[model samples]
Target: MDNNKLIEYLETFGALTSKDKLCLIDNVEFKAYKAGDVFLHTGKIANQVGFIIEGVFRYFFYDGQGNEITSYFMSENQFVTNITSFNEYTFSSGTIAAETDCLVLIIDRKGWELFAEQIENWNSIISKITSKTLLEKTNFQRRLINQDAKASYLSLLEQNPSIINRVPQTHIASFLGITKFSLSRIRNQIANK
Candidate 1:
């Protein structure tokens, strides 16, 4: 696992002892998905959590009117999982698909349980991860509730400029809770200014 990007990324959260590293090395698996692959589809039970070593993905769901509503987009060094389904062992409410050829480090439920049991200070790492996720969700919700489309789009540009280039315009529009036409107008407005 010397060249594994997942292990390298995990080290950012906390330093894993030699023993802890070995435990993770033994359990984590590497997987690759092609661009446009729907690795985890809606209504499926999400059993594995993964770290994006190289790729971009979006969490999307079909709204009642049969339109795709993208909730979030994630890129390299990020964790992408349907947390609600993974935690509850229920059907996933959305789909997670790669936007480009991607590599990920996956830890299954059993592997995660073993890692937690064997690794010291593992709970601290998990707690930090949980805290970050919560904060992001809270901020996103607050923005959606308080900010209009143009402000939300501008916020996205400020916070995640890379996403505008990696993801399609339509997906970005959906994530911003705006129409593609509206997104185009916003872009033109910004460009002219």
Candidate 2:
């Protein structure tokens, strides 16, 4: 992972000195995963936060019927974590699985705290990330509640076109809170129109 890119991303939220960037990079560990690998399993306590360097991953939950419901997708340059588990040191309700071969930069909770202490500007960056993530999740849930399957799928496509091509159709259906058949029908209808 290029530490410069990561630092540049952070710079979008606030200015970070080269020394601060180096300090943050020192704590990050690079990891790779196969397409089917599970990065975070449900009910497991996750101590690390991952920054995707390449490929995609899905954060999901299993329903009572043993069906997977994808809550979100993280692509390259994005971050992934079972936030509640990481924050509270409790079991996570969701799992994060690789959708493709992935490379990530991971930092454990301790590393995060150490960096936070060293970088004064990082507090603002962290707050922005937290608020943005919360808003995105809230808006997604609201859309799911108010929109039909087709509308939800269209909205998702409009928002994340790369996901439509990169993620599996079945997973996309789950993410949109629809059955595969429903998704197929929606796709067909969109194609016909």
TM-score winner:
2
Tell me the lDDT of model 1 at 41.
90
- Provide the lDDT at 159 for model 2: 73
How many residue pairs in model 2 have overlapping backbones? Answer: 0
RMSD for all candidates, in order, please.
1.8, 1.4
Candidate 1 on 30-102: residue-level lDDT in tens?
8898989886899999999888888889999998899999988888878888888987999998999998888
- Candidate 1 segments whose C-alpha is farther than 4 A from its true place: 1-4
- TM-score, each model? 0.91, 0.94
Candidate 1 C-alpha RMSD relative to the actual structure: 1.8
Estimate, for each residue in 79-157, the C-alpha lDDT of model 2 and write its tens digit.
Answer: 8888889889999998999999999999888998898899989889978888887898799779878999988888888
Candidate 1: pairs in clash: none
